[model samples]
Target chain A: MTILFEIKKNYELQKVTWKEKDILVNTDCGVKQIRIWKDRALLDWHVRWRDEVGKNSLAVADRMIRTSEGKPWVDMGSEYLTLHDYVEGTHERSGHEKRWGLLIGNMLQAGLELQEEFSSVTKEDHYSFDACLAAIHKLSKEYNELVSVKNSLPEANKRLNLAMELKKASSHVPLPLFDSDTHMNNGGQIFNILFYRGSDDYPEHGYQPLRRLLTEWLKECGPYSLRKLLTCINEHFSLEREQGYLLLAEILTPWELQDCVVQLKNEELAHIVSYVKSFEQDWDFNRILLHCFTDWMDDKRKRVAL
Target chain B: MSHSNETVNYGPILFQYDLYPEKIEEVGKVKKVISRRGTFALKETSLNEEEASWFTHVIHRLSEIGYHQIVPLYPTKYGDYTVQYGNRTYYLMPWFAGGDRFGLTREEAIIEEIGKIHFLTLKEQDFSPEVVDHSFQYLMQRWESRQLEMERFAEESERMPYMSPFELTYLSHFHHMMRMAEDAKRRLKDWYDACHSEKRYRSVLCHGKLSRNHLLYSHHGEPHLLNFEKAVLDTPVRDLAVFFRKAVHLSNWTKEEGGRLLSLYQRHIPLLDEEKSLLVSYISYPEPLFHSVDLYRHQRERYSQIEFVHRLEKRISAMRHIRDFCDLILTPPPPQPLDTNINTDHI
Candidate 1:
């Protein structure tokens, strides 16, 4: 007998047909499935939502087929089977950077509307930057002991070192963060918001989705992609000048200073020596990072950056 | 928080390619320099000599194997992929297209491509007895401790008049959790026994992570796999388990659909009974629960009481679905052995 026999019996459906597309092993659940659903209800939603993205509104609700009565989401489990219409098509990964930028802009705009509409919806209080620093402080001892024999230069070591320094650097300088509710601080105080394209489990360190997307566009799309993305952002959203500074900090400093050295050709580096020079306490580690890559940064272009 | 002291000039850099740039613009961390040669994107990063060489080999090998989607890293006129400017290394490549998975046809195509990649990268490694033992020991210790922790939590929950939200959620789903946990332990032990007895396993270049995020589909609808940053030599099942885990995430797909997809993979590179069993065991572990436990323990100071509890509750719901799927996978029909003889390298 098919697994759906039970679900059909329980749901009292006129007719339910589904194809099990894929199976996954999950830590939360031992086994799960990727399914394509065909029932009266989802068929309606799918038919309607086929043109939603083309309609210039990312109204996800149209595509979001509701679950069966009493169920939370489309159930891939054998026992209580339900489904949301599966998005089975392929999205082109490259080209049309301006288009993608516009698309993302639309999404962010839609997200902002949704966020406001669901303002009363309970927010999940996630870890804050203050807490992130504290967590890194607690884990620093473990990182030192866990150094393995990697065949390459361990970027992990550098990340850990930078993360630790970030604790001190961020204390005095407030970072403009993304307003992603998924990745939040202790008090639910969000500074900036940006859409992340990766896994829900992992959020990038800083909230510079625009910067990240711009890099992707430059490398994978066309030269005008960043301009398009910025244009989309400008048309769809608003920002403060300080947020622009945060965006620059999140971006310009590539892991290696030399990557940007050529770009830094003719500029007077901001003298941050004065800022730290006045601070008697808490400025020790921030001072160290400023000196780490001074050789690569010409003396004329020497300036303090957080 | 301060601006860079250096003003970025792309003119001198563009001269390295003997191309006069019409315009040079900052695009995120990289520079978009347009010259008569066409638009080239350059990024500077820190990488050791070995690392760069390995990446070059991997990308080139894939291209050589007819997977040209491994965006060619254009060598400098000096024939170097990386150009050292100060302490940084920069490499430029032709801009390739990127796309996401959409309808069913594309999904099938992407899966088929993965199967092909796995087949091409397949290697027979001598089944290391030490590796098996180490993995088994780690599994046993971790699961055993987790079982203990759950039990302790259960005991405390029973004693308290008012349970924490997480405790309440756990208790509500307690039976499902315990049953699945026990089954996971048993399945792993069975796999360990099979490994010890069979003493034959094949290794393939595992993508480590094969989410839709890494896949790039061109306008012509060809699939391109990206990012070998965390590539590892492991059993083909390592990749399969990851793919499977993600495939079913919040999906309405069934085991039949999953089985069909696996069959597609098997058509390219078959899996042995041992491998299948290992994959099942691998998927059954409550990794999400442990992740939640870690978050709860380490960052309780950061997240509110409701936040953590709600998170756990949501996870518990997902776990229930996983339980059903794992039960089906781990059940009695043994996997058939592949006909072709795959002799792995004796490491």
Candidate 2:
């Protein structure tokens, strides 16, 4: 039988059709979206995290719809499939600023609650500034003839040195024990944040292909909006002193420039120049972002001291 | 009693079960949720993290041990037996419509279900002198303190120039209540001595709150137990005492019916002699009567003198029934008259 037929048999649904990539199933309760997963560990983590979110009255993620036998997933031969409430909405970026913060805060709280179960399935954040510096140096040597790549080398080295110092200073700080999903921001566009009428006030913290949500938000949300987001997050889950140090170290690292340098290949000279130009521009933007983080932390420390 | 506004309040919890409520109706401690999915009984209670785990474990453990007469909890789409919403924990079960068995049949069904559970989980505990001594001393100290409080109250009432109706009623039955208290202490000592001598004790999963109200009959007349939130592993006498004490409050209850119910339960697992004494000890305690007086003393302004007197009288009457029941059961039948001629010929 076809996968749709299998879904119908397992979920006891009558009408199930493919809505592009996702399967739209008409359930007795409401319309639902069916998504399939190939990895068992990831599927288990998703089920657990979503279940925790659902239980805690937190509207941070879409809960998995169980099959007739009260299972979160229906097993096929090679893959597993799950259903979720099919929310109809559009992604809006301009408004709902506080709502976005509240959503992320709740997500972090939920993640912290399921830390034990989550830490088993996911890896912690491992950042190395030296790796980025070495990759940049090799790229600069490879493209020495290109003036853009050549000019950006000295500034890139200086930023790496600053990142190294911050990393060394914060070496005593430990990474958070909870599962770290550095992919909360829906890229820079934040398109996964759906807004529909009669929908929940908080939207789902969807998946992202971007490397780190905080770095991306620094480039996209500007310093002020990012501060608002962190402030709201801290309201729900107070950031510890050690966690603040680690976060500051992360902000100091030029992850965007590192990502660009790593992605550079033996493409045409034009692409290399454009890549170097973009990397330079992102590196400058990160400087401002670093300042924003330090400023927020210093202000918070002073307020606490007072 | 359809509550549309309140239905919105319960939406998040019901949504966990994929249930869209068309209406919500409050029934005692539970909410009857009428939904497109089906009708469900949603029980909202408060249980901290540890208590929640224990409560769910008890429910699953009961089923694992082949006790299926319980009202089963429906797992949410997330496969959790309970949904924690704010400080309250909510669980869903298929609503069992009330049947006509509201009287003796219901009580008998409750007793039988309790007996079945006790029989299934009954275990002989390794004799621990520390546990036995602590239990005996703790209970002895608490019962004595309560008994002393009642005595003081009676003395204070006697000293009054003009006694209230509640005071008069309490003073009248004060002697009988004290006698029952002493009798309970004596039985408790006997139980302790028996256990110490035998170096043995048995424990079963006692339904901490046993009442006819906690049992419901299905349409097919099969009774299903509910409210195991307070279930614990304790002496079998704990449950029997709780049940019989409440049973005596029924206007039609007799020592014979109580005896018959005990026999019905005994058919599943017979109570040992010490256990019987413990049961009598738990039942004979005049704690309930003292509660009536304490209520009158503390909250006299809240309730009228007639109300207090009426409550005290009702409890006194119930205690009388318990006393009679205990006397009838604890007493052995008189020795039958011997036929001397027949006995001599046999010898």
lDDT of 1 by residue, B1-347 (tens): 11222222443233233345566657655666665567766765675556666766777777787766444676542234555443455677654444554464544655677788788988877878999999889878988898788777678778999877766766776666777777777877888888879887677767666776666565565566665545677788888878776676646657766676777887898777777777777676766765675687667787877888887776766666556666665555577988566666673
**What is the TM-score, restricted to chain A, for candidate 2?**
0.74
Best by DockQ: 2
Instruction: State which candidate has the highest lDDT.
Output: 2
Interface DockQ per candidate:
0.01, 0.37
Give a tens-digit lDDT track for model 2, residues B1-347: 34577777887787677787788889999999987667989999898667777888999999999999899999876678887766888899989997666455877898899999999999999999999999999999999999999999989999999999889989888888999999999999999999999999999998799988799877666789999888899999999999999999887799999998998898888998889889999999999999998888788798888988899899988988998999876876579998765756555
Task: Give the per-residue lDDT digits (tens) of candidate 1, residues A102-122.
Answer: 444444444343433333322
Docking quality (DockQ) of candidate 2: 0.37
Candidate 1 — which residues are off by over 4 angstroms?
Answer: A1-306, B1-52, B76-78, B82-93, B98-107, B145-163, B301-310, B327-347
- The sequence of per-residue lDDT tens digits that candidate 2 reaches over residues A55-149 is 45433356676778878888887998877765554334324455545555555566556555545555533446567557656766766644655
Proportion of the native interface contacts kept in model 2:
0.58
